[model samples]
Target: MPKMIFVNLPITDLDRSISFYEAVGGRREPKFSNDRAAMIVLSDTISVMLLTHDFYSTFTRKPIADAHRTSQVLLALSADSVADVDATIDKASSAGGKVDPGPKQEMGDLMYGRSFEDPDGHHWEIMWMDPQAAEQGASAFEQA
Candidate 1:
């Protein structure tokens, strides 16, 4: 079986978070979801577990940091093309997520990326890269 990644996040509103994730190419997996938590399946191997603050705290002794005020991690996903990257970001924004919480990223055709903040301010980055450049290394694209 292929390995999978489940990212657990602390959110305030389960319903809203579920909707936001859905807008960004995710669908709620009811078998693993409940009132306090929702399992958003972003891809075959990528899932985001949205847990309320109270529920999330149960998994860790450390205090829950407010994502809106602090940064803990940046979650990134790859896209097939630059248009796809932008489309994801656009959908996120339409779903009420903040667009471009940080500056947009462009690496002269080598890579293209953009960021957005979920309702709870969790950061997400959508990116696309030149396939050949990625396999060949950035130096391969360097000018003479």
Candidate 2:
């Protein structure tokens, strides 16, 4: 059986959050959605649960962190190539997300990566690697 990953996030407004996510390449999962929460599907095995503040608080006793002030998590997505990573980052920023400083480049033959932040302050990293370089034990992109 294939394993699935669910990331739950607290949002100020369910509808607003859903719209922002949709603009940044997230698709709504109607089967898992309701008035207080919506499921943002990323891939077959990955999904993000956007829950209203009131609804999310019920799931945990600890206080929810203010994402605007500080981030509690960083979500990374891998791309097949460096150009693909850059394109996604551009789309994210155009859709109301924020890009990090810039892309960090590794001068070796192994890997390359770029990072950005989502509208909700979630950090994201996009990366690509050469299979041949991995077999040679290259560690160029490991630091980023």
Candidate 3:
């Protein structure tokens, strides 16, 4: 079995968060979801656990940080192409999510990426890479 990545996030409203994820091309995996939490399957390997405030609090003693005010983590995903990355971010924006003012650019032979923040203030980055360039060990920062 392959190792799966689980990203847990605290949400004010589970239903609303689920809707937001759906609008961004994520699907709910009911088998792994329940009233206290919902599993949003972003991809086969990447899944986000959206937990209610109470449920989320159970996992840690520390207070939940308000994403709107401060960033706790930045989530990034890979894309097949730059167009796909742009479209995905556009969909996020149209679905009530906000795009960050500008994206950081890292030029390379075969790597491209962009980043944005969701309505709930979760940061996300989308990237595309060329397999050939990867094989050649090209680094985006180096090319830039």
Candidate 4:
């Protein structure tokens, strides 16, 4: 079988987090979901595990850092086009999520990205890359 990745995030509200993920195009896997946690399938190989704080604390000995104030990691996903990136962010905003303040990225028309914060304050970035340019060679924005 092929490898798969599960990004585990501690969430204060299980139901709300599940709703937020679904709003941004994630499909909830009921087979792996329950009151304590929810498995949001971002793709066939990628899943986001939204675990309750009590359940998440069981996995580590250290204190759970407040995601709203800390920047340990940023969850990023690729989109088909720049419009897709914007659409996802817009859905996030309408679902009570917050958009991260920053200029939208554009790598000379080959790439674009936007950022948003989930209801639980987990940072996420949606980006699009030109497939033809990516297959050709190095990006034009790359330094010599």
Which candidate ranks first by lDDT, i.e. highest? 1
Off by over 4 Å in 4: 136-139
lDDT for each residue of candidate 4 in 11-126, tens digit (9 for 90 to 100):
99999999999999999999999999999999999999999999999999999888788877887899998889989999999999989644677786788899998877888889
Clashes of 3: 0
Winning candidate number (TM-score): 1
With a 3 Å backbone cut-off (N, CA, C), the pairs that clash in candidate 1 are: none
Quote the lDDT for 19 in model 2.
80
Question: Which candidate model has the greater lDDT, 1 or 2?
Answer: 1
Candidate 3 residue spans exceeding 4 A from truth: 106-109, 138-144
Give lDDT: candidate 2, residue 143. Answer: 44
As a whole number from 0 to 100, the lDDT of residue 47 in candidate 2 is: 93
Candidate 2 runs further than 4 Å off = 101-108, 134-144
Residue 102 displacement in candidate 3 (angstroms): 5.5
Task: For residues 95-125, write the lDDT of model 3, one tens digit per residue.
Answer: 7787753465456546778877766678888
TM-score, one value per model: 0.95, 0.83, 0.88, 0.92
Model 1's alpha-carbon lDDT is: 0.92
Per-residue error at 122 for model 2, in Å?
A: 1.7
Deviation in Å, model 1, residue 33 alpha carbon = 0.6
Cα lDDT of candidate 4 equals: 0.89
